[model samples]
Target: MKVIVEGLHSRGHQVSVVRSSDSWYIKETSPFYTSITLDIESGFGENFITTFVAQLLETQREGKSAWTRFKLEMEQAQKASELHENTCKMLEMLFENKEVIQSLHKAKYDLVLTDPAIPGGVILGHYLRLPLVFNVRWTSQGEGHLSIAPSPLSYVPMTGTELSDKMSFLQRLLNVIIFGFTEYQISQYVLPNYVCLIEKYLGPDTDYLSLFQAADLWLMRVDFVFEFPRPTMPNVVYMGGFQCKPAKPLPQHLEEFVQSSGEHGVIIMSLGTLIGELPHDLADEIAAAFAKLPQKVIWRYKGDRPATLGNNTLLVDWMPQSDLLGHPKIKLFVAHGGTNGVQEAIYHGVPILGLPLIFDQRDNLFRIEVRGAGKIIDIFTMNEDTFFQGIQEVLNEPSYKKNMQRLSRLHRDQPMKPLDTALFWIEFVMRHKGAAHLRTESYRLPWYSYHSVDVMLLLVGVVLIILGTFAALIRCLCSIVHADGTFRRKG
Candidate 1:
């Protein structure tokens, strides 16, 4: 959004942002236009992470049985949903403030540009009766309007599942089940609470799903190469690598470190924002694994130093991830497999050793593995041997590097840059007054009709009617034949 806002501003369009105070990352960016920070106290941080990690640890401790793991996951999902509902409630309360409502009403914006995770924008757009453009920053992670992008449940894995694009028969069935669970999650756990909050102010007639489905455009953060090919509406525009920029010069320290590594090269390791620190034992194991490698390691460690730091390792609170990846000296990336980080690695043609911690990380890693560009190391059962071997395999193997480079070229071989594409659509919506023509009629249709389920039923009905008629005719013929035979015998 920061990139889009700045780009729009540069093109002489006025932009204003309504931000939640809880978003500490907002402070890092300086947008060209007005930023109205809602100072409401939404005390909700990502409180579920601690609980989620605890659950994961417990699941591991209990021998990691399939049933136990499934039960743990269910519990975790329930807790996370409850947390999100409370957060939504807080946002609802904030939006109900007289000052906030009056200010929003008076602002009279042309379009509401919003992140999909934030429900506030959907409500505001509905209340204002303006068009909406949902910016999905991650690759199909959130609850999306299925009308806009109908996900193929048989192939496309659900949000939390570790399944990949290609699936076995059983896996596909499980995928279907996961799809149903996802819908259940939305309808039963997520959307009702949001509907209550929206209807509280907007009245009973305003449907939450309808308002969300009414989004004029969706700027998804994905590329066809990285993501599996699935059915999508015309309104969905894939603007992958929108956040990628040309490599900049590295810092002096980083430059020196890269130069010092010589031909052995360096590896960049980062687990993303949510998982700030690794467990001490795990950290020690990782350090020990790195100690055997010839490549210098630049690890973004937020916690205390590991028990043993390899001489070839550089531990820092943060590193210029893109800049480092762009360097010729950087051989591979050890990442949590977040879409953005994975995209960045792909942009730079760097292979990866993925240690997926949670959420979409597992799925992202699966995609990379299927592409033959990376390997996944389970965080739960990651021994020093597996970690070291993963590093060695990716580093020594040429196929990983070759595949990554090939993918990188394919990703960059777009007709227009992702940002430009996104901007065009953003303006396209404005130029054509919401671009309603781009949306499929399926958007307004029920699921039964949208996917031609009704048509299937109609075809089935016709076939059934014909079959029934044929069966009756055959029975009548048989009865006549029997009657004729009986008459002959009596005569």
Candidate 2:
């Protein structure tokens, strides 16, 4: 969103950012945009997330048994519900605040630009009858494409399954089961709170899912280079790696560290912002692995200093990740497969040694691995030897680098910059007062109608009726012939 804001501000657009008062990132003042701070708690506050993530990590470390998996799923659902419930409370406050509502109405913004991962902005956009544009990869339910596009379970893998486009029969079955569970999660855990708000404020006829799928333009955060070939809607625009750019000069300390690595090159690791620390024993094993590596390691961790810390490894609370990835001395990336980090790695043509901890991290790394550009380490099962071997395989093998560089070429060869493409579509929506022409009305259709189940049932019924009539006609003709034969015999 900050990237989009910067782009729009550069193009002489006045932007107003609405954020929670407790937002960790968004500030009250900025040259780029005017900030509107709401006095409400966003359920996804830092404390809530950090605590939740810690719990998840602990549960995962309990082993991959069915009970552990079930616990993890249930915990995730419970947290999702809590998050949505908090968002609903905020929405309720916003709706009740006449002053804020009036001000928003008077602003008359050209469009509502939002990440639909949380649907508050989506709902508000509909309430304002404004053109909606989503800067999206994930929605409140799951992947954005699953909601608006034709996703066949045969190939389009569900979020947590970590399967690719090509799958065996059993994999497809697993995909279907996962898909069912995902739908159940969304309906049971995520939607009810939003439903109440919709019915109370937007009227009973306004469907929550429709409000999301009804977006005039969906600036998708992925492209075919990173995603498998699948059915998509016209309104969905691919802007994968839009946030990625040419790297800037690194900080002097980091540059000096990279230079000191000499012929061995450097490897950097970060598990993104949420998982600041690992289980102490796990961290110690990772540290031990780094200790064995001749290549210098930079690990971004906010955990206790591992007992096995090596002189060759430098642990920091944060680093200029993209800058480091783009550096020529950098040999490999050890990442948790966050979208931003993955795209940047692709942009910089760096092979990954992925340590996927949670959510879509595994899937993201799986895509890279399938492309031969990366390898994944199961944090649960990985030890010092396995971890070191994974790193060595990525560093020692020339194919890893070659494959990643090829991907880099493909990503960079776009007709226009991804960000520019996104901007064009966004402006297109505004200029046209909405890209309704491109959006599908499929969201408005009933589930049966959308799948054409009704049409299929009608066709089947017609065929069955025709066959029945033909069978009856044949029986009647046979009877008549038999009666004639009997009469002739009697005469």
Candidate 3:
């Protein structure tokens, strides 16, 4: 199949890509340059200014040799952390390279797939008028914010909503002075000033919203085991855990260590790439928790350890996460609840204790918690006491493990793997010229699209008012005319 995939390309099926790549050599480390040119964190098409700024904030403490690589990332993060500002700004490159992209789109492809992360995939998918699969790794990519948007304005970045449900009296009064009239106008007026750098540089594309609705199908990178709301749509399938590669072999010593741990098992601690830092005291408490447990701990700390150490605990800067999770001897997983880590935990059937820091971490862990497959430790309020106690509870109880195992079975019981499921749907669309008939009946409902509670109430109010007005007119006429003689109208 002439399939085209647009994503990190680090994993998943092979496909064409138009993303940013800059090589920075280690020896030449500076704000201007570096040794390795790794792909940008968000997606491909992010232009120079935004990429430079984002990289500035996302990096850890700068190395003396690195020469302000750390400083740049931090500075950029401060400037453009808001989603609307960040996304619209990052898409500048799309506007700049419009002609070239248009030419690329005209080229033939059997199938086109993209992530909502970079609306480019959606862009290319639509331009070609080809079969498109929305690879939604994040939950907010859905139509609504799913009940967690910080403010109504917050939805502007993700959903393009125009109003707030809970506009406070003070906020309304302040907005009158600040924004004049119409909340939508106010947000639109201010959005450009804050995040219009992207639009300024990238130019424009009018069809930005169509890419979302015109999807042929969607390949969700979420397992049913973890996502509790359960995709109510038929076309949206759960095959998130499927991947092309097999597990790499574990080191002999590592294998022996896991096997020797017995029923107590090994506890794996890892916070995925973005939020790897463990607060000083939390790390100590975690290490201490390991001391209390019979199970040996294999923690991927990724930073300098505290002065103390326990005999049974092992800490390293890196770990073979997938391989370790696949190990039969591992009993518990401590994760930051990133989508990838969540999928990995479920695939291996290991119970997870998620400590979410920011962004989708809270949403990701919330899903797992709601599904009854895992436990969560709030990063903001979590202390050594709660952390230690949570771990002990997960370890001591059998329910969490049993539930995880049950989910794993259901996940694996599918006749077709997730990757295969995605492949079939993609091909089906290609063969049928976007087999859109498969989209569910309910999604097409007027209620689904309109979301008109207030509108419905208004319609009822109009009918009642019209009826009441007619009744009043009839009564007035009857009072005015007395015994067929003309009379004054009733006041």
Candidate 4:
């Protein structure tokens, strides 16, 4: 969203950012956009997220049993529900505040641009009667595509299923089951609070899910190079690696370290922003694996120093991840499969050694692995030997690098930069007041109509009626012929 804001700002557009007062990342001041700081909680505080993630990791480590998975799903749904509840509370406050509502209306914003993972902004957009543009991958329901596009469960995998576009009977069954579970989660945990708020404020007829589907444009943070071939809509524009750019010169110390690796190249590891530290045993195992490698390692970690820490590894609280990935000396990325990291890796043509932690990480890595550009090591089952072997496989194999470079070429072959495309569509929406022409009316249809079950039933009914009429005519004609024959015989 910052990238979109920056692009819009650079294009001489005035931007106003709405944020919660307690937002950790969104600052109260920025040159690029004016801030509308709501005196409400963001629902996602740093500590809350950190603790939740930590608990998730612990649960994962326990085992991969059915009960364990069920527990994890329940916990995640509960947490997600709590988050949405807080978000609704915040929205309630905002909606009740006549001054804020008046100010928003008076601003005459052309559109509401929001990430619909939380639907507050979406509801607010409708209230303002502004065109909606979603900078989204995930919605409050599930993946943005699932809500808006035609996703056949036969091939298109659900989020946690980690299945690919190709599936056997069982895999497809699992896909449908997972989708059902996702719907259940949305109903039980995600929708109630939002539904209540919507009914109270936006009227009973304004469907919460429809608000998301009715967005004028979706700047999808997905590139087909990394994503599977699936059904899509014209209103969706892919801008997966929009944040990536050419590598700048590295800092002097980091440069020296890369150079020191000589011909062995360098391997960098980071588990993204959420999981700064792993369990001590896991950290030790990872450090031990890195020690076995000849390539110099740069690891972004916030945990205590590992007992098996070696001279080859560099530990930093944070690293310029894109810059490091873009560096020529970089060989393989040890990543947690965050979309940004995966897209950046694809942009840089670097193969991955995926240590997926949570959420879509596993699925993201699964995609890369399916494309033969990476390997996934189960973090729960991984030890020093397995981790080391995984790294070596990616580093030693030529195919991983070759495939990733192909993806890079494909990502780069576009006529316009992704960010530019996104910006153009955004401006196009503003120019047109909305892109209703591009959007499909499927959202307005009932479930049965959308799936054409009603049409199928109607067609069946017509066929049955025709067949019944034909059968009756044949039976009546046969009876009349028999009667005529009997009368002729008697005469």
Please say which candidate is ahead in TM-score: 3 or 4: 4
Tens-digit per-residue lDDT, 442-476, candidate 4: 88999999889999999999999999999999999
Worst 10 residues of 1 by lDDT: 138-147
> How much does candidate 1 score in TM-score?
0.89
- Model 2 misplaced stretches (Cα beyond 4 Å): none
For 250-301, candidate 3 gives per-residue lDDT tens digits of: 9887888778788878998887654444657666766776677788988877
C-alpha local distance difference test of each model:
0.80, 0.92, 0.58, 0.92
- Count clashing pairs, candidate 2: 0
**Tens digit per residue, CA lDDT, model 2, 1-491:** 89999999998889999999888877789999999999888877788989998898989999989798889999989998998998999999999999999999999999999999988899889888999999999999899998799899999999888899999999999999989988998889998888779999899998888888889999999999999899998999999999998889999998999999999999999999888899899999999999998989999999899999999999999999998999999999999999999999999999999988877888899999999999998989999999999999999999999999999999999799999999988888888999989988888889899889999999999999999999999999999999999999999
Stretches of candidate 4 above 4 Å error? none
Candidate 3's clash total is 17
Least accurate stretch of 10 residues (summed lDDT) in model 3? 154-163
Better of 1 and 2 by TM-score: 2
Cα-based lDDT at residue 420, candidate 4 = 90
Going through the candidates in order, what is the number of backbone clashes in each?
A: 0, 0, 17, 0
lDDT of 1 by residue, 78-169 (tens): 76567557657666766668787788778767788887664667777777778889888431125353435667777777766778777899
Decide which is better by lDDT, 1 or 3: 1
